[model samples]
Target chain A: MSKPETPPAPSCSQLFWVFTRIALTSFGGGVSGWLLREFVQNRKWMTQEEFLNGLSISQALPGVNVKNMAVWIGYRLLGWRGAIVGFVGIIVPPAIIIVLLGTIFSSLSRYALTHVALTGAAAAAVGLSLSMGITAARAVPRKAVPIAIMAGTFIAVALLHWPLFWVVLAAGLVSVAYAYARAS
Target chain B: MSEIPHTSLLLSLLAVFAPLSLVTIGGGQSAIADINRQVVDVQWLSQAQFVDAFAISRMAPGPGSLLVTLIGWQVAGFWGAVVATLAIFGPTTFLIYAVAHMWSRNGGARWKRALETGLRPVAAGMILASTYVLLQAIDGGWFARAVALASTATLLLTKVNPLLLIGAGVVIFVGLHAISLA
Candidate 1:
């Protein structure tokens, strides 16, 4: 059964505050999931398909995925202004806090324990990062060229220590060329 | 570079971070190694201080790329932070905005598909590479490595919150330190 009614659009401030709240509350990462729950499930502001589509585009494009996603959702719901709200909501509040924390950490730099706690936190955060990589890797199609590009990229950047600009540019050219040929 | 006037330093931060923003695909992790390199090359911060900033960014809320904000503050002051933040985040904002606009209006064009499909592998590769670099740079030796691996597993397999895992890591390291001292 097709649904007959679409939900009314949320105001720009409503959009901004939601993003700001998510930015403020999301600790230790997983912001994308939070976004999905808020827009797709909780408020029904955006459909699941729309959210997923925006997510894929955000992931594939340059720039921060969350910021892109925020803009994507905001633009869809409201327009240009909504997009700006999304950007500010997701970034500004947290930027302020991180700077404050940095200030405190600088003064507390003498303590060995501060560094130790930071190290521990950093290590555990790797779990979040690696898990994300695995998820992305699994999304690649089962084919030789894509797999090769992925592996080549890792080697160039990680093992070989090639500069990222060159690696991404070179590998992206090859990968996109291959996709273009395959498409035709 | 440090001796440059305030406005100039702010511009340089904007310059450094703006281009890096375009390369920060796949959740911003892919850009960290390059960002570290740029920060080092520019003499904005020392390697040790950069790592410290990275740690602080990870520990703080919001995007990990906030490391630049921390970097700016360390190098200059309040406006430095604002400028660095804008530099890192502003240019790319236009990009995604344009893409978002076109996507909704046109609805799944061929080039769009090509771009998304083409970039996926590169994004994946970059994430893996950045993860490796981070692994090499973090502290606590084997214990740190173990926690990272275990945390990875838990995240992949379970629904536990990441903050809890990071807190547990801090507690474990502190406990280990106390035992070694005794």
Candidate 2:
């Protein structure tokens, strides 16, 4: 039997521009989900299984999922050139926005209207964050161990006001132990 | 008020982003609690100011980490914003590029998979922890709690874009402000 051939990789320039569009337009939150839908599901830039695998790896790495995805996808597409293009695409739009907002916000600082708008924005941000938390919690493998870790950590930090570092360290140790116990 | 010297502004921007870039091993957003501890509690910026920058960053497009630029802007000015933006992204970008290059050449190794498996839970826990911290900081009144709850519900129930929610909140705030003025 003949072996199936791996599909041709996307060109560096194509990957660069596609990621650029994602970076420029992905507003408000869950950019990673949006990215997956667009690049993997819709465009078939990657298969769904590959995207999920990429996501798992991206989340496990030490960067924003979107940025990490960009890097991984870039590397997958055209090696190093693709990676650079993806990184630039990811950062450039936000940099521009920040610069412009920085200029405008300073000039508008003393305005009462500005403060009112900001207050509303803050309220919305809190809501958005809460929503993000719920979505993320839903994604954790629905197992007793992970759930317990989640609940315990939430209580430890939210109710008891433990330092963040300690909460993270404690959760990490517990998770590792749980995994170890399960394996053996 | 005088403009901060360009050099000092640049130095401060670097000061903020350089450490954040390195320590943010998992991404800039994950470093938020740490950033808040260092900036807000340490008096680099006030709590309200941090909240303001964060809100603005979320409202706008692109990465959440870009809030560092707003903080820089508040501390200094235009030049500071530019420098801070570059400082924050520049090093991280370079590092990611180099790492990607190496990973690609290595023909997809098992070490990468191991690293991913380890970091997954840690990143998730960090996000959960950050959420809790933010909740504590922002929880004050019924209105705030209500808004948060409503937003969360909307996010969970529908595919409505967050910008719409943010815009609606702005409108509500303005309306409330107008009523109070009256």
Report chain A TM-scores, every model.
0.91, 0.79
Question: Which parts of model 1 have CA positions greater than 4 angstroms off?
Answer: B1-5
Give the alpha carbon lDDT tens digit for every residue of A104-160 in model 2. 865787888776687677677776666666655666667877777777766664567
- Name the lDDT of candidate 1: 0.84
Itemize residue pairs with steric clashes in candidate 2.
A62-B25, A62-B26, A63-B26
Q: Provide the DockQ value for model 2.
A: 0.43
Model 1 chain A: weakest 10-residue lDDT segment is: A175-184
Candidate 1 lDDT over residue span B1-182, tens digit each: 23444687888888778777877878789988778777888888876677678877877888888888888888778878878888888888899898887776784466666777788989998888888777878876788889999999999999898889888878887777778889
Quote model 2's TM-score for chain B.
Answer: 0.82
Report the poorest 10 consecutive residues by lDDT, candidate 2 chain A: A175-184
